[model samples]
Target: MAKVNISLDAELVVEVMVLAGVGSPQDAVEAVVRDYIARGHRTEARTELTEQSLREVEATPQEPQG
Candidate 1:
């Protein structure tokens, strides 16, 4: 865990706490940061899978219908 001193808007912190259902400002901030990081990982994984599938399709030979 890391600790840092920073300033934040009281109203915004309260709103985030309420929306996130967290009791502490620290918890709310941590939850939002974790969620943001997880979203990026998911997006990267999806992009990699899509590229691999496209490559496989391109490499496979097509059959002609008479």
Candidate 2:
């Protein structure tokens, strides 16, 4: 496989390591890049966040007996 060079914030790297849950920042970068390249940047983060927000809103029904 060919390799390319890129830069990212150290904090962001740490966060990715934690999220990847493999205990290695190098592995996290490789894993993320592989998936991102394969998916061609296709993402649903916004839609998932919207769905989560809606679910939270619906779960907290307004109290009428104030």
Candidate 3:
């Protein structure tokens, strides 16, 4: 594990610890960072899927309407 020395707000740290259900400040920070990354990944996947669907629709032939 890489050791990092960061200055954070004490009140915010306490809040994060409670919200994350983690006993240590390090664990709370790690959990929040993990959650943030996961959320970004999920958003990226959704965007990719949406673009793929749009491409498929554009590729499909449109029939003439009377």
Local distance difference test, each candidate: 0.94, 0.83, 0.97
TM-score of each: 0.81, 0.47, 0.89
Q: Report the Cα lDDT for residue 46, model 1.
A: 100
Runs in model 3 deviating more than 4 A are none
Clashes of each: 0, 0, 0
Tens digits of per-residue lDDT, candidate 3, 1-66, equal: 878899999999999999999999999998999999999999999999999999999999999989
What is candidate 2's local distance difference test score?
0.83
Clashing pairs in 3: none
lDDT of 2 by residue, 1-66 (tens): 787788889999999888888678778998888888767644576667889999999999898995
Q: For candidate 3, which ten residues in a row score worst on lDDT? A: 1-10
How far in Å is the alpha carbon of 31 misplaced in model 1? 0.3
Better of 1 and 3 by TM-score: 3
Stretches of model 1 off by over 4 angstroms after superposition: 63-66
